[model samples]
Target: MKTIAAVMAASAFLAACGSDEADDETTTPDATDETSEETSDDSTDESTGDTIDYPDLSGETIDVASDWSGAEQANFEAVLDYFEEQTGASVTYQSLGNNVATALGTQIEGGGAPDIALVPQPGLVDQLVDSGDIVPVTENVVAQVDANYAETWRDLSTYDGELYGVWFKAANKSTMWYNVGVYDDAGAEIPETWDDFMSTLQLVSDSGVPGLVVGADVGWPLTDWFENVYLRTAGADMYDQLAAHEIPWTDESVVEALEILGDLWGDETLVLPGGAQRSFPDSVTAAFTDPPEAGTVFEGDFVAGNIADQTDAVVGEDANFYPFPSINGSEPAVMGAGNVAIAFNDDEATMALMEYLASPDAANIWIELGGFTSPNQNADTSLYPDEVSLAIAEQLTSAETFRFDMSDLTPSAFGGTEGAGMWSILIDFYQNTDDVEGTAQALEDAAVAAYGE
Candidate 1:
């Protein structure tokens, strides 16, 4: 079976992120000599005969675009460098950071899409496909993906039955990150059920420490909070229906979710002071904040880096996490997000990059660097630098199932920062979780209007 380029250099490139963040500075690092290894990037493939075709794309320059910066961008550059060395092609990366989608859309609409793009949304992939602008997935890339990833992941990058991209990087937002030291000092066991988790929070508070920190500086944290509780309480079918707007936000289950979250948010004693104004980074630092403002911070795995960059807590030993406890029986569902690698340019050099990115070869470059997660099951777990990385990988892979960000799936108008979206609406709810029904009705109104439009 064919895998991504086996550019056997004496050393693999370092493109992964650290607590230092992914650097956006583009690098066209020189490639290393190509040597053959008997191993394929996808270890699951039964056949590893020498029949794989590795194309030589020397002298061709391909441009890639993504919203990733800090360690993510650097990790990508390392992969590009390996691909460059194997195929002798020059590659440049553009880290659009937070403004990536708009910039990519502008470029695509203006007839200047990059050779390859890592899109964060399935809807965007569909949008590009519907517009007839994306370079359709070729058979070669499909072979690598089918061998490397699960059907769900493959479906995520697909439009209809046809594949449009590869899900490269992923984040597990189903976690509640906290300071291991604080949690241990309390001598509390990890709660397995939602009710018990709340009890645990109250226990922490009773111990003269704030139990939880809710940061709205980046409003999506609340959105994630709602998603977690909603899925756990209402079931996946209902969650999907709500996400698709098939059911109104005023649905009873939706109200229940908000109320459940309110158990934490509404409690003045349990939650940190001034949660509305605490930025995401501030929340990351809050537990480790000098004198310690809070004990637990819930968010995605990315917060590990923010914690490292802002504080000196060592992961696993000092900084650690637990899966959000389940409300219903069975495993609480995992709500997460990932990037789908898509191409707009049909040129050979461009398709090659897509093939390389989807392979374990590229993913491993970052996997080894830490502060990153790979859903590509074929990517070796041993490559992870620490216990924290291995544990997160387990959370991501062992999940009964995974979902991309719900907001990213909806219209940017309601789910996004536009008028009356989850961002603003959730913020309002955080400020006043008092009127559960009123807040739920407000969300439905916005959803109706946004979906109506």
Candidate 2:
């Protein structure tokens, strides 16, 4: 959680640039620690014999566990510190470093899992929910988030008809970022359609500036393209179909999306020299810094925070944002990385902490700390660190539709295979731009092999 400020900044500087389905029957088996007896549906209160024991903060101590570190950790501590002051509950904060899932399981078995824990990845949420490692949050907490955050977030947080966790910050992935100065100098118009966008890329490439620089090695940035294409061509339902294993990867839409991406990669103007080899974190540097820099790239809302330390480029004016253009003037679609808090024990202290974290005020605290776009629908936009972030907050506020990461919606095995397939398709496409049909077939074949026909 070092924030990888510089690393993310460099990647964010790239448009600048800019799930799921499935039935319980067809779902991947839950992979969390088998030791966990608690399921997401479990509602037993350990402190009350058999009843849910609400925490009476008079002299109780609650421990919280997470992977948050550096600024992220500090911000969370601040939130908890404030919570302690208000509730008179003494709290201990523990940072478990990187091995969170394993540690949480061990600690939980030992009766330790901290009172409240932050589960960052969605796949983990699914596993945790199934294993009873975490329980559904209370109705009040759900209500608080519903009132403040966007519906897309609520939908993502809710699984199998119950609210298992409440998200504090959600990363919006359907975004493109560009250098204001570069655009101003070239008089290039921001692209609004997929064709227009490609044309603009050609124009920028023709201008002899780095047209687009993406760190393909990161895998996630490359994912941004597939997500957008899936939305543009197949729409959400189809996208969901792919995620749920309902549609084979060789479907027409999947093939077309790969071809389009291949075209983008084939363009010499799109990538910086050696960009194909760069990691996603470092690609941003190639795009923004002097000499061999790019004019545009694609990324997510968190890109701003990642870039906050580099190049004095302010958020609103120096940096600006636009949604991933309509694939064909269709509704704007978005992919999100949502973070959640799960409740395992139904004890009072745990419930109170859960309630506090999901509260509108807590959501606002997260926005002010500057790493997320709160999922709480009512979070105050004014609290965002900068204009660009505030603008994103507004977009989240008005967003009519949103989807979680496609790879995250399925089992890790499926997501990993799909991600690897995407990279393979992109690398092949980049090398064979002229062979669109061949490349498309190859991509389709690869996807089918990965997920089966």
Candidate 3:
């Protein structure tokens, strides 16, 4: 693995090379077809100045699997189209839906695993690595990652000190999407501190609009809310300790975070009419649709996509987001999730595709098409469709302290399973805000059972 210092030096060198390329482009005309043909055999194509010399994979066919559908599926297919155009390789994509783990496992067991799988959870990566079902990426891919990704992103794709995947898409979960018209009507300002956030909620409520709307129907959004608060108040060290079950959920830190959340969740006047019963999509639509139902909805950057697709709201105008408010004077912390492309086969075609996905060239394709964020630091932020999307992408790439969604790092039974563990406990807490102590105890019990502590 390359050290951070080595990565920094390489970045500077790449920047210098880019500057020189720009100068040459400004002074010289386009190369002749003959010149392009002559340099085609070289590692670096002089005609296009593309650094990676993709092999002619005319007869190769690679199969990829993921859980993406709808607009997300279309956006990723655009990326695959570019890879095929450049390398002459045919690609097949399979949408395994929400049960990707089960579907992929069945394929692997039946000896029919796809060439690449876009995994969404680190825990699943650990499973694949432990089972020896996936292979480490080539050195070419590693170089792209070191140059284009932050250390946290690189680490998320690594297991047992070996790199296994490339993070192609990222989600900034520490975003609070609000209706611009509603905020203006309520005379509400974006809050910076915890106390300010609470006051703003009250202010919005006093103006005849509910302060917040959350989708607690499936329980994952609630986990995101808890994660943002816990990450801010408890700090990163204790946050990690709690995620790994090293510290019991009954600790004072967990209780304090819950109590803070209760200040808003406990007050019915501050929440939308449905309270915790609202579905995720409904919550998003409610906040941004015409004649907005509430002041704000908290979720990931993907809320922008929902607003664009489901509602007629124009992003960056009718809808926008602020960072999840700072708490206890803590430094900015971003909670994020991403889909990592991991290879099951290390053939020439597969490795070539992996290298492409790691490059900014591939990331830029989907980024320009809207409703996507890339963690690749080398990607062009200016390509983002709007300022709000650009800001979210910048925060993801530039955050000094980034943590994956905590539930994503834990076992399925504890973190992901419906109506159990943290999900159930938080739902119960939402329904009965006075049971802060019981919520903490329930969480600890579930964590102990799930983690076998």
Task: Please write out the lDDT profile of model 3 over residues 386-447, one tens digit for every residue.
Answer: 98987887676556667777886776668866678777788888888899999999998898
lDDT of 2 by residue, 55-75 (tens): 448688888777666556766
Better of 1 and 2 by TM-score: 1
Q: Which stretches in model 1 have alpha-carbon errors above 4 Å?
A: 1-60, 98-100, 206-208, 289-291, 328-330, 416-420
What overall lDDT goes with each candidate model? 0.70, 0.61, 0.77
Instruction: List model 1 lDDT by residue over 214-273, tens digit each.
Output: 888547789989988887888766776777787888989999999988778989988988
- Of the two candidates 2 and 3, the one with more favorable lDDT, higher being better, is 3
TM-scores for all predictions: 0.82, 0.71, 0.83
Which ten contiguous residues of candidate 1 have the minimum total lDDT? 2-11
- Stretches off by above 4 angstroms in model 3 are 1-50, 55-61, 88-90, 96-103, 106-112, 275-277, 397-400
By TM-score rank, best first, the candidates go 3, 1, 2
Higher-ranked by lDDT: 1 or 2: 1
**Candidate 2 Cα outliers beyond 4 Å, as residue runs:** 1-123, 138-155, 159-162, 275-277, 290-292, 347-349, 369-371, 399-401, 416-453
Candidate 1 local accuracy as lDDT? 0.70
